[model samples]
Target: MQKHIYILLTILSAGVLMGCEGYLDQKPRKSLVVPETLDDLQALLDNAVIMNSNVPGLGLLASDDVFMEEAGWAGLFAEMEQQTYLWRRDGGFEVIGEWNGAYQKVFYSNVVLERLHEMEEVVSANERGRWMALKGAALFFRGSAFYDLVRIFAQAYQPGVNDSEMGIPLKLTARVTERPGRATLEETYKQIIGDLNQAIEFLPVTASSLNRPNKPVAESLLADLHLQLGNYSMARDLSSSLLQAGTLLDFNELNPEDPFPVPFLNSEVLFQSVMAVYSFTFSSLVQVNPILQASYAANDLRGRIFLNRQNPQVVTFKGSYCGNFDYFAGISLNELYLINSEARIRTGDVAGGMEVLNTLLEKRFEAGTFQPLEASSVATALAFVLMERRKELLFRPSRWYDLRRLNNDSEYATTLVREMGGNTYILAPGDNRYVFPIPQVEVDQGMKQNP
Candidate 1:
């Protein structure tokens, strides 16, 4: 069901309006017994473009959607795809999609959460759970959205850091009234962590195995957070738990003729993308990056997942499924567990970590070739884990986050900065361009854009 219908059902059952009131009053959420100009607030909900993500055109530009006559969404996220490391300043049309989707969805999530309890008691138990889960999920998403924005839009996270660094503003509980000032880097990270942690506590254990958030999702995120904060042990523990709990999508089971077909194509996926309601991302714009196609071995499962044959080169994206997906975004348990194992390795548990990583990878590669790790030191294992991460998580979104963490090494950072920007656009440690600018509209209304 669409997320909206779930909301509407919750509201209408709750009297969608307060009783003992004038017959003419119409408020979807009767929390306010005040007189209103409009009937139900459903109209507000209707006009609410709580974005799903990418906003189609945005995804096209960000990836490989070809809508315009001049530019296929190729050049926009071009740098990132090639690991050239791109950043946008001024929040141009280039980035407005992310800004708009994030803020708008945050507002929509706010509306639902704020009014969910006021609705009637007739809502079913599972329904209520789903509703609350959705609310928490939305909050988690917004928090993450902000986190991503801040991470790229501002400076990279430096451990034991000061609070004065630029971080995105926190916007919780919707924007019914005022704009908030920029939160401290510490404050923003706190909010993001807070929301995600709370989301882990509330949402269903299995939200989206592939693309969306859930309990495991929350845990995986926490694992990432702890890793970034240098809490290696905590990250290792979180990773272990998520991996043990979540199911893996066996790529070994790929049907050669139709790799991306239903059964959702991935067992690790808890839920698939749904467009009829609570909508936004579909695989509508996925062209395999040339780099990816070149990197994949002919025998690799990913090669089957991608398209090859660009002009003379054999590179492809989502193939026929590029613009077609019909379900909630999926969440992949497989990748999460692998990342967890990697974290374990980083924390000096080479044996334990390799056990987890090899289990997944053995199933990924052909029969008898999985190499078990017997690390001599933390550094070697950590290096191995990082390489494994790149090899395993090719097209996933996790790479962006991984890149942020790794971008700190002066040499690594400089190389990436040069690769993406070339000579003229050299990226500095404290440059604002490293992060996305807050939307002009938000800034006009007094939002503190990253410096």
Candidate 2:
């Protein structure tokens, strides 16, 4: 279903042709065309969010730029160490795939926004709601992509010093000739919030189905922004609000054959994209680091997700257990509730937060066993909450953000990342190499690239 949408996006974008820099080069050979109605925009948006999904045989061979040195399918010999993801950081594989995916999505947003006004007659109660939702989704995508660009390409979020911080190109109103400057971190974040609030107000809490964005998705992002800014209280309140109201998939009910080690597809997932597994060759590239492996206690159900694959030294969790069980679906209600739980702790509602965390753990843990956190140290509580976040969200593509947030502080900073041959590597905060560089082509065309 997701892959089908990308095919449509290619057709829509290709029909318009050459308006954007990378429009001509999108993969899978699609024909571009202009969107004439709301349905067209929504379809394009859907594909934008999912993109080239399923087909587990094509696993992500992208390297971690700073951690491991591996032979990538692109025939590049590279090693990644701490704070590195090749496609995201080095603009080769991981970084580039995500980058291309983001910009291509952004381009679709631009085309729709440009053409939306021409179809004023199409507006109605249902259509109006849909329009607002789609716009919000676009902003959400753009804001999210840019937000990452700032964190990964620039510096950490320091509220007052944003102007001085080297942020990503703030693609405010998508215009072909708009020579936009890199907006301050403060301004960029403000825009993200504004778009989200509006999105939440307009988008229905219920999505078209399980796999699309909706009101909770907007709120989930809002909570994420606050958390990154160190606005613990706000993060706590908003996250809690979203979680308590959402429905989550009970892991206990999971089919015995289905191997979703990380239960992210619960009612708690605000929105979901796809849950898929790839070829065995790709599976070898992914294994939980020893740090996480050792962290899981015997009582914790999460330990089951990580498997010892025939040897004590070689361990891969449930998500990575085998090619047959690798399912990949994005956020649902369960995650939001966890976010709320973390927020509760961050806001100093230690009891409230612990209650939520335990509620979740009780289900994941065996029938009756669960650990109750004391959260005595504000520091410990914060760390504990984040650890839970990591455990629950393992392999969901959100860890990079967590790592970026941690990189700004010692308590959360991780010296650990995927490691390979020889255990030596490099990441350049000096050049913002850990974050993403503006695609060199994008930089050439007047957009201010990150430092």
Candidate 3:
């Protein structure tokens, strides 16, 4: 199976690299071996290097969770990385792996979907379940990629205001000849929600591997999407349903002295994915935001488990649910808990929300040191949930999405500031720079660029 995957990947890579006209216009070679069997399609998705990992990392770089000193900023090897860290908009990103990697997942998903459509009529009765699972996995991958892309490249979805806003191009087919233009933000999310809804119905209750999508994984992603869209009732309902069976790993079980306290694919993770590797991420000069580090209580196990303090001002993040140097980009029960807690509070179930928040926190802190968190009002409960969400999901792409969505709410809006070499940079709420510019290569091919 590994040998077969290698051959397929080689063929796919050749085809993708054969064109330079546009990011999405790479036509597969006519002589290439096409995936025809269920095993073949499954193997394609199972290529975890391409399908599971390689999620966008620019969001993590741009997020406020970590920062670099001037020396670290100057030491970054890639100008694009430095530019992204500082939120520059003066030039197109020369290296667009973040954009290309996401679209690569879309391309592979389309390959599976198109092939499945071809074989649907002739699928044997015994193969029906496998067929549905493949289709569901493909849809989930596509929807997941689209969601990541929009979160990075488009403006925040404003209910009535985003109908006319430009969004990432929606590539629904494998044919490279179809150079579809950018979809409206409304159309983009409609496609994502529709794809995920179908995925939930077709996927099995549990995936064969944590790297694959399942019913619960689709539901979780959809719930998160709705939460970002401000559909609190729907988000709360979906997250609540998942939590009925979800479990979190107690921090007490982990040794904070270990380089990575959370094991890879631990019990709490419903899916597994790592962010695209960036030199900036592992740079020695980068440090956790001092204020964020200080927010963790001394008795909170998460403080010791999630961060490595080199000194008073040089603390670094060590807790990646991926359980290694790679930053985790996967969905976990911890995230769903936070999502449910916030959604419940937003929807006026303040007491219920506090209970959910405290339940999760109890497992995060030292076994007996955690006290139940209380709030006098919905406003206070929301503040607590949002702050915990930030702490709990540090270094994950969640912070970028949170920043984008929360900026719309006046009460939670934030102005991010960075200081280096006697210079200060500020990103105000709703700044146009929040929308990343499309890759120039794609722009040269006639795709619209972000402002």
Provide backbone clash counts, one per model. 34, 52, 0
Point out where model 2 deviates above 4 Å: 1-31, 48-94, 121-126, 254-266, 274-281, 306-311, 320-329, 417-420, 426-431, 446-451
For every candidate, C-alpha RMSD to the true structure in Å:
8.8, 6.0, 3.0
> What is candidate 3's CA lDDT for residue 25?
66
* Candidates 1 and 2 compared by lDDT, better number: 2
> Mind sharing the TM-score for model 2?
0.77
Query: After aligning candidate 3 to the native by TM-score, how far in Å is the CA of 387 from where it should be?
Result: 0.2
Lowest lDDT 10-residue stretch of candidate 1: 61-70
- Residue 100, model 3, lDDT: 78
TM-score of every candidate relative to the true structure = 0.69, 0.77, 0.95
Give per-residue CA lDDT, model 3, range 118-222, as digits (tens). 889999999999999999999999999999999888999987977789988999977677778999999999999999999998999987799999999999999
**Which residue segments of model 3 deviate by more than 4 Å?**
1-7, 11-21
Q: Report residue 102 deviation for candidate 1 (angstroms).
A: 0.7
Error of 3 at 306 (Å): 0.8
lDDT of 1 at 76: 34
Per-model lDDT? 0.50, 0.55, 0.86
CA lDDT for candidate 1? 0.50
Over all chains combined, what TM-score does candidate 3 have? 0.95
